[model samples]
Target: MALDTLDLGVLAAIVLAIVIYFTKGSLWGKSDGEDVSVPRGSSRDLVEILAANNKKALVLFASQTGTAEDYSHKFAKEFQSRFSIPTMCGDLADYDYENLNEIFTSIDGFQLVVFFTATYGEGEPPDNAVEFFDYLENECDDLSNLKFSCFGLGNSTYEFYNAMGKKTVSTLTEKGATLVGELGLGDDGRGTMDEDYMAWKDGLFDILKDQLSLEEHELVYEPQIKIEESVLTIDSPEVSLGEPDDKYINPSQEEAQSLNEGPFDHTHPYLAPITVSRELFNSDSRHCIHAEFDISDSNLKYTTGDHLAIWPSNSNEHVFKFLDILGLSEKKDVVIDIKSLDPTVHPHVISPSTYEAVVRHYLEISGPVSRQFVGSVAQFAPTEQAKAHASKLGKDKALFHEEVTSRYLNIADLLHVLSDGVKWTSIPFAFIIESVAHLQPRYYSISSSSLSEKQAIHVTAVVEQEKYPNVDHIVTGVATNLLFNIQLAQNKVSNVKPVVTYDLAGPRQKFAPFKLPVHVRRSTFKLPSNPATPIICIGPGTGVAPFRGFIRERVAQTANDISVGKTLLFFGCRNSSEDFLYKDEFVDYSKKLGEKFELVTAFSRETAEKVYVQHKMLERAKEISELLNDGAFFYVCGDAARMARDVQNVLIRIMMSERKVTESIATDMVKNLRVLNRYQEDVW
Candidate 1:
């Protein structure tokens, strides 16, 4: 209190230093302060990016799953090496719109090509890229001199093929970004996507070559990582398995229900009691299972949208063969370190965990192989015989289809056939893991109402059977097989149990083996909060899964003071008499919920000309228009990529014809429906 001015001055100086040090950022960053120069595409980080002789080109990919990302990374590497154009892979979220605008506002001759795969990965971006893309889409940008190209990967089977790509290209063009090549699209369902991309690549490169206006050196293979034998081994990568992340990894259930937590997961799977499994169709050739898992534990609770991840083991038949070829079944403890020349690639071509794990849960060595895989590993062939055989198999689709897919054989089986039981390549285990999608859960549309059977989850799926040109028949769907086993246990038909004697249980006893690992997903696709809002459901065949739950909910609830919306369902099948599934159940439900439900059936094979759900909607255009005018919501649950699109088209036309609305008007209504969450389709 009595301090002199000098002492006070020193204290103030110290305080000022601390304030200036911490608050300096705000002082210069003030909106009204002196203007600071900002780069277009380059952010503050790019400002400090040390200049090099090679120019930088930003490559951005809008990927759902990892497909677009994989391809984008591959191309980026090629661009870096061949043209010597230093490349940086950018996510849409990382840079600001203004930063990108700055990068393109001037005569910077660099390019920004976007690889987009339309459709949601977990409803948008592969759980990793959604926020970034959303930011770019929302933020306005100025790209006067920027040149870009778009390559979209989609499934023609789905209605919204390359939708994101189409929307993206339109928006960027609006912002004045010049396009370098024709917008590219790849379709996966048709299986022509890869070659289609290859076809487009030539034309794409021609345009890129012109726009880039740069010389091309010889394109040579340069892997990003160095592959060596057992030289660089680390602790096996730890898999988080289940346990939800930020996005609520639990199932999408309409109501709370018990869930099984353990005795099942990526690492340890619950050999849940399979109560029921049966053939959905009477086709001996096809394999489909209708299974119900006993979820008696609160920890195993699931919502409707959650997927049940099943840890699958290679069939013992295939496992034994793999062991024979690798000649390592007896050497269980001999651990191997894998290092691929390409770090992007996995080091272990097999299982990184253990032999017991491989046979029990890892990918089988024997199965259908891709042309890409054959072409990729061809260089590693040990002999001329191996090279020729591999090259032939890679190019010959017929051969691959007949020998691999038809038999449902894995790598080990094929090698046995190819090498006549010779020693298999000492391929690393990690490669197999990287090549295959982690054993994803086989999702079933809950076929029953949660109210009636809170713990029971039901799914309807047709078995798959394909016989290639003069080849053995093959049947598979790892989880489906388990479903079949569940039916057996439920019926007590055979003493066979779904649970196997595996390491997960550590040889302990259980209720006869085989546990189903499942989780629930919460769904926004439930009945409207106001049940009075009418709904039009169009689903073909098994697409009717979710609709079942929707109807069940309406029936189970009391109607004392409710405006139960009229429900119109359009279901299609091959033959009405034999394949009209849940026919009796629908009739019973309709009788009880009269005026609240309407069932429409279309059979594609009933007549020579095939009729689908879309045709039904068009035929009832007048009625549909009236329903829409009454504010009815549209639900297309079956095929989002195709049938959904087709139904949407019919809806738009109906609006145009009956409502006397323009096509643009109809489109606006559709977009509004989307924003309002009215036009919802759960197609896969």
Candidate 2:
């Protein structure tokens, strides 16, 4: 899922995590030529624009990444197009809450005010929405006349599901705003965000017709943007071609200057050298990489439990497929500029570059295609049969799921299937840019303790590969495969070419010598402040990354003669010899800590029946309950969907059986532990 609209402001500090319970990758490229100039409407405030345009509807978005912003824009566009309601999309950061009460009086009352917000980490609003959130919480009052509706984007896996959206609706109601419809919550964890959004909009529209006298107009395909060929040639140095920043456009002059630059962030990542690279798992087929990055010269610092974000480029194979399907492969080097014809519609990818850059660096051409996006492209289909198929697939939910989503078919793949190798030249490149999500950076938990290696950060990533049933090609995780390629290159490993290869040299060899652009991200998942605090960790497969750091820190502390409490780690894998990561290291640590450090293993393949971490936790129910009572900081890191939930259930069962508490009481106890920071999770 993409970040909220607020991501533009706070994206740098934010980490795009890929918690490999043996899993994932994403991107956010910042070419030096990337748009830095202020947007056109910067001078005029939201209220002023609303009044000037006579816009009755205002959709305010507080997006952590860009998903909320995208939804807000879509809503604004739909409202304007369908009901002829002048709607304007506004970022929460761009408006002042002090004058929010004037919306009713200043513009003869707003017909509608919609909020599209995403709840970020720990139930907090995105950084850009923080001021607005604060203002609503403390200062804002008396919105009795203001009519509104809300749609919240959230992952159900997180404890604070839809917190931001729920709080917004609550606060608005408290201030006496008339809620037009039920507060909509889109759960990304369940992959029902689109369905939830569509359903909510239906309810919202019905209410709008009765309240605001809105009448639906004929829905037609509207082009939100214009595309044109630029005079700039492919050989032009100014053209962006997957370059990180403008510094890379002319590296000779900027390289030295960049070296002396003070700050390096998401826009400008420090190219850290890999000091060591090796396979964690013993198996050849299923491999996990353990790599240590040298951040000594990057002026980057991180404590234990922090994350390291890696910005990755799209695979050439995927890029080529996208370009080829679009019939832009031959003219990929031809420069083009994309401009938004509608002010409400913004082009996600900055233009005035070759088609290659747009396909390779900007667009998310690898992910599953959205039905809405496919529907939009249907009108541009080359053949009548293709057009009919596309329309049916888009309109029919079941057909779409069966033919597209279930098949793991991306835009290019779907197009190929529909046209049978025919290129979609009729489709506008501008629309492609508008439809696709921006490439986001992938993050991994720093597996090395800062105390053990202050100047270095280690990451353990399992190369994700899964064969889709009935599909000819295997599904490969983008970032993990890239890392695997890098690992293979670094260790000089032979055979088994990875699914995709990367341009390791990185824009004129700027990132040579095994360098990866990365930055540190702070996390709440931390060990107890006291060294003597007992910790129970349940991490199966590559989820052991952070736990490795935790144990290493303790090992170093123990070596320094510091007293450490019992650290019981419940780890699971397919087999002990196959995918057991850091096995030798854990053995060595146990020898140092004696019974203070206990390593519990669950190898499913080793036995006739499958065993997992949850089973192990339940088996040691009494010991686990006793440790919890003794104030042990219980930690679980792995797959959020299944593993985390299962482990939590196991812990609750332990509490119920051993502590002789009811199920509800046990659940509350677990919740309380989370509230007290005694139950920490670093799941994906």
Candidate 3:
């Protein structure tokens, strides 16, 4: 059969089309019939989105760990429901701010823009909000017609407390945007962030009502998402039974092997194996863990002072308790599909997932109950008496604090008490999905030098367990307990019962025995690049994690025939014999480094006066001042609430005494050192 020129051309085009289809158009620029101009999700323009959706209010969040985003969603929901205004909540990263002024002109009537921003480390904007902040600072000039409000979530322990929120409000006001209410600041350091937010929100609502002449209606439960029971079972390949994403849900063997491949990030984590796990402290009452992760095959990289984020699932105890309280115990394994009721809203959790899997892997059901959330759920209480009690707990802040906050009662615990053995069956599943915050990864300081153990990351953690005076239940740390149980499993220890049981064998046993979903987060806390630079470290307890890495890094440099400088470490613990961490290792380090390495120990319990690291620092004030004059770097990593503050004050006092400077001048000198990057802190 002889083929003509036209026939051959057509055949060649058909073959190319098949190749493009199989490769998803990667082999070529684009598929022949593909429309590349179609929008993937939503319009990035603020004006276009607001006008298209006919939204009167837009709530945006710049969040690092999702706290600000959660608060924004709560605010948006409340504002819309109470004032009968159409509101849209979105991430700052998803929007284009060049048309900020257009939103004011395009949207008719009283349009509002609300910002819920969190100040990241060192007063930096969150990664998602960087672009928006850049636009606000550089491009935005006139927003005279715009009206906005801002609420900042911050830890006062940090020097630049609420910097982002304050900056945003200030910038907006400078651009002539009228503020709807006073700038709100929530202090996480004081553990009054929730209370602060609620108070600010109440006041903001009052202002909004007056400004818009809005008549508030009775608050009722409204579901932002719709959940339907699907016919699929938990065993179905289409259902995600604790899988992170579609790639892990019944993946092929080839895909499974490559699951830990590169580009690991917040959205995707590498399942790294735990190569080493052991107890650090000798005390029987207090436990501190030292675990190492094998990232050789995973290709996950880290530096000496970086952070390792560990993704953890809720314990079976908490998961089951949550299900039992919600009356979903019988239907734990029933698959359900979730859909967002509003066009602007998106489902946070993956579907079709079982109730147990959602509760275990997605939602944060074990945290302290929010007072506002308690009030919202009071209407759904089973009995009138329960409703009254719930309402009182929600309204009376002092009483609520005494009953719930002081005792550390989680949502499940509170519900169990309110129900008095009855299940909250009337509450909608969608409401639960909307109200509860999503589970976030826990971060730990990487306590290993990348130069020495390039393929491994180390974590030192103190197992947190608190028992309040009158509370029958003990509050336990989630991630630490998970690690402890994993350590117990890996060590083949049979005598000790598990503190909290987790699904160690992750979805389909992918993370069997001892493996964790982890990723590295780059940190600014780092040792000076020059090896000869002198360093002074103050770290108490597990705060010594990064300092260990720094010392190891110097040791590695010296092994390579590099000249190392004076290394001074001030470490504090309860008793030298009982809770002293890495005692033998420090001794070995002292031997290796000789006169260059010095370890100053402060055994608080051993001394009746309760001498701490600050006391030790004061004793060697002259040497510390001499080191400062010699351009030595100062580092502190410990409790931000007390220890970090104390260390800083002591440093200032030492400068005042040794340098013959005033107290104010010494304080300014420390501040200058921080600005020059000569002083660094990794507190809290």
RMSD of 3: 5.9
- In order, the Cα lDDT scores of the candidates are 0.58, 0.80, 0.87
Number of clashing pairs per prediction, in order: 80, 15, 0
* Best candidate (score: TM-score): 3
TM-score for predicted model 3 compared with the true structure: 0.93
Rank ordering of all candidates by lDDT, starting from the highest: 3, 2, 1
Per-residue CA lDDT of model 1 for 1-684, tens digit only, reads: 798999999999999888778764446442212122431234524312212212367667665434676566556666666677766554454444455555543325555544544445213444335565565578766666666777777766664566676766777788887777878888776766656665566577776678667668765445433322332222323211222221112235632122334433433344455555555554334434555666655455555423444434444445566666656567433434233332112322232234434344444343455555565445555566876787787677678666655566666666666666666555444444444333334445666666545776666665433455555534344545545544554465664433222222211122245455455544556667777888888888878877877777677654444557888999998876666767778998898689889988899998999988888888888888778778888887765556777787888888788878899998788778877878887777
Q: What does the lDDT come to for candidate 1?
A: 0.58
lDDT of 2 by residue, 27-137 (tens): 332222223133335543555666755678899999865678778877777787788777778778776676676676789646788999898766779756989888888
Backbone clash pairs in model 1 (N, Cα, C under 3 Å; residues 3+ apart or in different chains), count: 80
Model 3 poorest ten-residue lDDT run:
31-40
lDDT for 457 in candidate 1 is 65
Model 2: per-residue Cα lDDT at residue 61: 93
Question: lDDT per residue, candidate 3, 318-397, as tens digits?
Answer: 99999999899999999998866566777678888999989998888888899998999999998888899999998999
Model 3: how far is 591 from its true place, Å?
Answer: 2.4
Task: Please identify which of the two predictions, 1 or 3, would achieve the higher lDDT against the true structure.
Answer: 3
lDDT of 1 at 330: 71
